[model samples]
Target: MRLSQPRVHPLTNDLTPEQAEVLAPLGQGGVIPAGPVLNIFRTLAHAPQALKAFLTWGNYILSKKNDLPAREREIVILRTGFLCRSGYEWTQHVEIGLRCGLTPDEIQMLKAGPDAGWSPADAALVRATDELHADQFISNETWTQLLTHFSQKQAMDVVFTAGQYTQVSMILNTFGVQLDPGQTLDPDLRVG
Candidate 1:
């Protein structure tokens, strides 16, 4: 798939200052700064209740503060990004995925789907999400294998997380979300 590379404006403290402050602790290194979304958020003046709900759900999945492990959460997100071909989603998460312990190879394997020599459990999780995203449901065999390793709660989390990232993938792709200026793209993500 051809990835869209949008042009980003120069880094500025001019955008959504609040969101920038929030993202600071995430260690962005001033490379890929937050873009126009912040201005939209700020223009709303206060957190739109709808956007707040979305943020809450996203925060839960991204941090897995809801209880799923970090590695598992990244796996769901990275797979979703690749399946949807969301360059913004894939680029953003690849950095976090590495921090969460997913090697570049494992993240790349996500493009190969679940059968790329990953462990049975990891493979099952990837395949389950890919199938669910594309087909809106998973095969029974994949479901059973998923149940074998992850608890019902985790299974649910994975499903929700995949759906969440899929939504993000659509938005980023549709809106032409650009990688922040000077932000490093994931070296492992092949550009075409």
Candidate 2:
């Protein structure tokens, strides 16, 4: 966590009428779930329009409509969150990544990065994410390597997922969104 307390605390209840409407998708009868997503939603509800816009694109990225497979997309997401050192993002995505078929061992290996002996395709995904983080763009070499395994659309989704999570990571870190209950922060992600 970048800050000891939230710069904008999660709104737990007593949402205004407009806030309730904008946050309706998160729960039934205006009650959001208790978790990191809820914290994020409540904080973002401070700007309902922006939150609405965020959910629209975010849904597409996480949905089957995305060109990348769920597991592959999770790889990019976890890698990006790790690179960004966003504890909340990392903690939340670890659960989602597991559901998407990532092993605990593989999630740890992601912190080891592209050279961690992943298959060629998985390595390419990590390399692409690293390149985008370090250079804000993928290299031609990584791009070519990715094409060998991914459809062009999948390759594009790799970038899309990376960019989106990078943004999420930034928000979670900068906003001091603490870890959700029951989440253990990776020791590697702990800031001094």
**Number of the predicted model whose lDDT against the real structure is largest:** 2
What is the per-residue lDDT of model 2 for residues 1-192, given as tens digits with 9 covering 90 to 100? 666689988877778888888887674421223334467778889888888899888888888889999899999999999999988888878888998899999999999999998999999999999999999999999999999999999999998899999999888888888776667887888887
The residue-by-residue lDDT of candidate 1 on 1-192, one tens digit each, is 134642222233553655454433333333224344432223222334544566667767766454568888888888988878776678777878888899988878888888899998899889888888889898889889989998888888888888898887766665555665455555544456
Q: Given candidate 2, what's the lDDT at residue 53?
A: 92
Q: What TM-score do all the candidates reach, one by one?
A: 0.74, 0.93
The stretch of ten residues in a row with the least summed lDDT in candidate 2 is 27-36
**Global fold similarity of model 1 (TM-score):** 0.74
lDDT (0 to 1) per candidate:
0.69, 0.87
> Which regions of candidate 2 deviate over 4 angstroms?
27-37
Residue 105 lDDT in candidate 2: 91
Give the poorly placed runs of model 1, Cα more than 4 Å off. Answer: 1-49, 184-192
